[model samples]
Target: MSRLDARFQIDYPGFRFDVACTVPLEGTTAVFGSSGSGKTTLLRCIAGLTRASSGFLQFDEAVWQDDASGIFLPVDRRRVGVVFQEARLFPHLTVTQNLKYGMKRSAPSPRRIEFDHVSALLQLEPLFQRRVSHLSGGEQQRVAMGRALLTNPQLLLMDEPLASLDRQRKKEIIPFLQRLNQEFRIPVLYVSHDLHEILQLANHMVLLKEGRVVATGPIQDVFARLDLPELVESNVVGAILETRIAEHEPHFGLTRVEFLGQSLFLPQQALPPGAPLRVQILSRDVSLAVGAPLATSSVLNALEATIAEVSESPGDPYAVEVKLDVGCPLLAMITRKSFHQLRLRPGQKVHASFKAVALN
Candidate 1:
């Protein structure tokens, strides 16, 4: 069953976020757009903190809003849990105490979440007695996540939850977030403008432009159809793939992931087989050759594909986007110099390859 049925419109000074969309009742749905693009505002509306001018909001068949009947639930009354950009844990409260607040509120909840499950999923056992103020930025965020889970909500909303942290902190928290999604089977509505995070975390994308939804679909199809890459940001160029951890190789310090029939040796942390994973491969990092080359190079992940289409890229070094068919389309950004070097043209057979570290 679909997890969410929602729509809303909000007016701000010279800005309007009139969004109408449907999200899966499972997995993470990303509300992705640039800053001041109404990502946060949309999340607020869902939480019942920001009232919509007129719309409908439902969670798993429960009606939170229906303008026709003027049905509106207060923020506190709605069975929704929200974790904001800032880890707003009570400074005076210990981690355990802060977590307890949400659990106690859910005591009367008809569908309450177990404390042990929440603690285990978020790795909160080690910091149970530590004061909120004493924890690092990442640890505090972990605690905040635990608090939200303890609420036992039907849906989860996250508004740029990792925005306030540095790169290291973001890395530390993402794994936990993914674990929460799988462990609890909670539907998440995540809002963000960071493409890397979006590619890594979300399975569904709701592309917003000027406060209106421009496209929505499985991320791959949406990207293939999206012509305006400028709407996003620089360094926001890549594609996502579903990969599974394969058996390990002791000789080489690399982890293999089954990409299709081929096993891609990626510079990822090793894991056991059958573990499902997602990987991001950057477009710029991809290099193209006219045919499979017998070269002496460490670069791996070579795929045979035909150039289906090409487009002009904006930069000092002129570039073009090449479409490759490894079942799905793969994007490669090649310089004008190299394009002329290979005498590359459309409908030409070519090989695309890149380094393992470039996978990120």
Candidate 2:
């Protein structure tokens, strides 16, 4: 396993931050939290742009930082690439030139990423001859990502890469980001405050609060933690499912997905059989029933589940969050009245139903 282990101690006038965690160094590992949570600071620390007063960081066999040994690699000495909120492309250069600039920085080696692969992965072929000023916000960002990839770094750091884009622009760029994870076998450290974006791209997560690492694990398991709502923003609390395309019902405009011995029908997707998919189910979209849902119901999915925990919803006195183990943990939000009426308690068997549209 390619793993990243880190411990940090940073101090300022009034604040002291202490954190430690180990995460797999593959796929997208999101650094998630709200404002002032030190998400960016952690990213900078990993990139060697910011030094933690007392820290240790290791990726597989390479030691990036170890304060105890007085070893601290500077940014230039590290094989890391960073993409900020802005594209930061050179306005006077053509897209080709900008990408070439990134390639120029890397030491010559057989492992260096080829320009063609980066171009195709990011869909930058058409923009190669265009000036940086001529591309749309999304296009520019795609170019920026391509440039980063061409650096052939061991790890890529993205600090809210989509923050500057509008909703439509974000939508336009998500596929490319997905490709970066699914198609290219590159390790990424994605920093973002937007839970929606994290849900869409991250496989694992590191949650921070006041510069401290509160939780770190597979995205699904981390989201299932009963203490999450109390530790971070509660509204984003939800579940993730790793599923495969089972079949498609073209006539009904829906597709079937199999997850943990259960099947769910979602809005039609053209993916072929066995294509892997990751879907998010918001806690608010889930409801609990004492028995299996009837066929007449509009809800497309319901599965046997057992209550794992019951906790108060952050800032919502009238409702409580229920954690259910449906193969994987599924979170549900229900009114206090319903909680009492159902007599819900841990280990109770019930059915969890959710509309397929709730799967994002």
Candidate 3:
């Protein structure tokens, strides 16, 4: 698999931005951080929009920037498609014309995306003849994405492309973004401070903290790490499990997914059996028991797990975080009072339970 290697350092009067990491060139890799964490700054360094004081960047075998060799590719020469917070479309031009402008500037020989295909992918045919000025916020963003895809870029850089939209608009645009990754197989560097967005869209993550790299790896691994104080303090720490639909229990109005021989139940899904599914299990939603509870309980999932680790929850001193291994890693947040009562320790056997309704 190809990867993007980048190292950059920039200094200003009161702030400095420094980052070094290599992320795989597949699916979506989210550049995640709070404000002033250099999320966008790092993205600009990769996009060639902001030149770093000292930097070296390479995409797969191609070196886009290297200070040692004095090689720096300009924005246009890099062949990267960028989508910003705003659509930045030409109000005077119709949507079709705007999309064609991107197609015209694309590299001709290796052109992989055509205008019609992009139009269909983004469902932009309805607004093609309409001026971008009259489109809704969500519709305008769809046009912006179509234009970017039409450029036939080797990589796509998005800086909070959904930040300006309302909840409904964000919902409307997320499916299109997922399609871009699934169907087109375009490597995307999506910059966003929203954890919800990262969880929904990113396969890998580059976590930043005050202009420094805090963590970078597959989303599941990164989230499971206990050393990252930044994540622990965020109070949203959890585990992401990749599973496949096993079967649907129509009578119970539930769907079953299997992961490493363990099963989890969720609300009924319209997707067919054998379809891929990614489920987010927050630590707060899980409970640990010394032994398997009776089947008479209302909770649906209760898997036998072995205690892996225990640590204080950074956000709440009174609480403790427990890591468990049930075919795969799982996390549970419980009060310190219960921690002492159970005397939980590593390598001990336990059962992890959570209500099926807790999963979405």
Instruction: State which candidate has the highest lDDT.
Output: 2
lDDT of 2 by residue, 180-217 (tens): 87766889999999988988889999999988898999
Q: How many steric clashes between backbone atoms does each model show?
A: 1, 0, 0
Q: What tens-digit string does per-residue lDDT give for candidate 3 at 84-126?
A: 8898999888888998887888788564887777788899999
- Tell me the whole-model lDDT of each prediction, alpha carbons only: 0.78, 0.87, 0.86
Segments in model 1 whose C-alpha atoms lie over 4 Å from true places: 91-93, 107-112, 225-228, 295-298, 315-317, 337-348, 357-360
* Candidate 2 or 1, higher TM-score: 2
Candidate 3 at 165: error in angstroms? 0.3
- What is the TM-score ranking, best to worst? 3, 2, 1
Instruction: Give the 10-residue window scoring lowest on summed lDDT in candidate 2.
Output: 351-360
* Alpha-carbon shift of residue 356 in model 3 (angstroms): 5.5
Better of 1 and 3 by lDDT: 3
Q: Give candidate 2's whole-model lDDT.
A: 0.87
Q: What's the true lDDT of residue 80 in model 2?
A: 82
TM-score of each candidate? 0.89, 0.94, 0.96
TM-score of candidate 1 to 2 decimals:
0.89
User: Candidate 1 lDDT, tens digit per residue, 79-162?
Assistant: 778898898999888889999887787637666678888888788899988877889888888888889888897788898989
